[model samples]
Target: MKDAWKRWGAEDERGALNLIGPDEVRRAVSLVKSGEVVSLAQPLSSKTPGPKHRCGLQHFMNRDGGDYAAGGRRPGGFQFSEDSVVMPLHIGTHIDALCHAWYDDELYNGFAGNSIRSTSGASRLGVDKMPPIVTRAVLLDFVQLRGKPLAADYSIGRADLLEAAAAADVQIGRGDAVLIRTGWLESQTGVTDVSFDIEPGIDVEAALWLAERDVALIGADNYAIEVLPFPAGKVFPVHQRLIRDYGVPLLEGLSLEEIASRKRSTFLLMASALPIVGATGSPLAPTAVL
Candidate 1:
């Protein structure tokens, strides 16, 4: 297995996020000359497509127009509507907290992971602890380069990353968010045939490569950021190494199609995790401004 340790110190919860200092933010701002902002989040709804095991997004209206029609009185002839949502935070465009995946009963930065706080959520390194992510980002359009979506079982290696970066003429730097486009999300044409178990994503080598460059975040257009069906004799190698060992956040299920279509490979990225206390993950709606 790959090595696991904390460079941000034992008490640190932000992990590689610590790399995003003032200079990183200022450098990101310099990439915004075009003033064009594009959303990189998929809409969240009960109707949103997701794997069966995730249970799907559920939405309910607490009050609506039907209330008054059913003889329910309105105060001062005024009416309003309220709604509620119940769904897994990992279902939509979401970011996994540093404590999300671990092994040997230890989380990122050596936090105890054995005693899970099921009711209250993660006892440490929850999504709330994550700061708003603002920095430079570079998109790797692997789909367009391949002329189609990569295979479900495809393992994206470090060479692929370098090739794509060179093609895009973008030099990935420290504190930058690297969003890889697999073209998998747009290939969602049906429910039963959806390849949920397997996906095309970065391999462990690629993940370590980014970690070497001190990337703050890693994202993908697929549900899982690493190749699914995993490498032979391996399981979630990227997740364990990146999130647990390197303390990098994983942004999955993003909408990179629009930005890729525009051929904008580099931009200023701004994303925030919902301040859900102790939650292991949070739904995200990141934006890229060129």
Candidate 2:
């Protein structure tokens, strides 16, 4: 891992989120012209394509009309239904907390890797520590540029990001959120088609570029933020470098087709992760106000 771990200070837990301020938020709001809210999350279900290591969400209603049929009565004619979801926090579109990845026995900002215990979860840098992210976000639609799904195991590099940003005519400044659409998530038809063994994603070069820009968040419409088949001599190196070394979180499994169709490359993004204390990540139904 790079020696870039402590840029935000030893005790700091928010990481790159510290870059966001009043100005960055205002810049994002200025881009909201039409006030159209576009959902950027894939609906969670037993059918959503995901790695076999974790089972899909198992949802069930806790209260419903079925209760009425079972001799239940409504008080004051009031009726309501409630449901519960049981699954990994990373079931669908989600943000990785800085504690999600680590190397060399240390987490982001030098938090001891042992601080993350199976019994208690992360003692520091858990998803609960993450604040709601509101900022300017730019979409780099590589799908339209490539005219198809990025080839399996494709590696997106710094130059590719620069080209996309140039074509979109947007500046990827400090504190901006960059969402890259590879058409990977949209291409999935079912669980049978999902493959953790391969996917198109960013490489170390692209990750470093974003980190240097001090981006508050980096999201993509894919499984892992980095390319699959594990880069030669690397195992999820991007995740380690960004999350553990640079304090940048990864947003994965997004649904960007709607926003891309509108032909607006820049917009105001608002995302709040589930305040899951000590968890590594949280599912998010992020919204883009275009």
Q: Write the per-residue lDDT of candidate 1 for residues 121-212, one digit (tens) a residue.
A: 78788988999999998999999889999987788999999999998998888999999999888888565557678888998899999988
Q: Positional deviation of 131 in candidate 2, in angstroms?
A: 1.0
User: For model 2, which pairs clash?
Assistant: none
Candidate 2 residue 224 Cα shift, in angstroms, is 0.2
Which pairs clash in model 1?
Answer: none
Per-residue alpha-carbon lDDT of candidate 2 for residues 10-76, written as tens digits (9 for 90 to 100): 7888998988899999988999888889999888887776678888888899999989889788889
Per-model clash counts, in order, read 0, 0
Candidate 2, which segments miss by more than 4 Å at Cα?
1-3
TM-score of each: 0.95, 0.96
